[model samples]
Target: MQITVNAQPHEITSNTLDAALIELGFASPAVATAVNGAFVARGKRAETPLAEGDRLEVLAPMQGG
Candidate 1:
């Protein structure tokens, strides 16, 4: 399916958010996810379904002084 990740177009084969993250090389658990402007918790990623043209945002925390 075709989806947008971080404002970029990506073709992925996973149907769920968790699988998609793994397929997209986002295996790190230190990131947060949002689908179509809504936040998806880590425990819910496995149940969160994704569709074509959906917007997925993966954000990683940054450490500052």
Candidate 2:
């Protein structure tokens, strides 16, 4: 399947957000995930399926306030 990450297109075979995280080399789900301009809650990643043209934004904690 094809999806856009931060506006860049990429081909991935993940059906779920968790799988997408792993495929994207994200070490863990302690961060945040946004799909297609919507904020995907932490508990919903497993059930949040991704589709073609979907946008995925993964964000992690930064050491700055």
Candidate 3:
């Protein structure tokens, strides 16, 4: 399916958010996610189903001083 990640379109095979993360090589869900402008919790992404044309925004903590 085709989806947008951070305003960039990407092609993926997984149907769920967890699967998508795995496919993208993310080892953990220590970050927040937004689907089509809606917030998707890390704990809920595993069960959260996604569809085509959906936009996902993944936000992770970054170190700064």
For residue 48, what is the lDDT in candidate 2? 95
lDDT-best of 1 and 2: 1
Clash pairs, model 2 backbone:
none
Q: Rank the candidates by lDDT, best first.
A: 1, 2, 3
Candidate 2 structure lDDT: 0.88
Runs off by more than 4 Å, candidate 1:
none
Q: How accurate is candidate 1 locally (lDDT)?
A: 0.98
Name the better of 2 and 3 by TM-score.
3
Which residue pairs in candidate 3 have backbone atoms (N, alpha carbon, C) closer than 3 angstroms, thus clashing?
none
For residues 1-65, could you state the per-residue lDDT of candidate 1 as single tens digits?
A: 99999999999999999999999999999999999999999999999999999999999999998
Model 2 lDDT per residue over 1-65, tens place: 99988788889999998888889888676788899889999888889999988999888888976
Lowest lDDT 10-residue stretch of candidate 3: 23-32
* For every candidate, C-alpha RMSD to the true structure in Å: 0.6, 1.2, 1.1
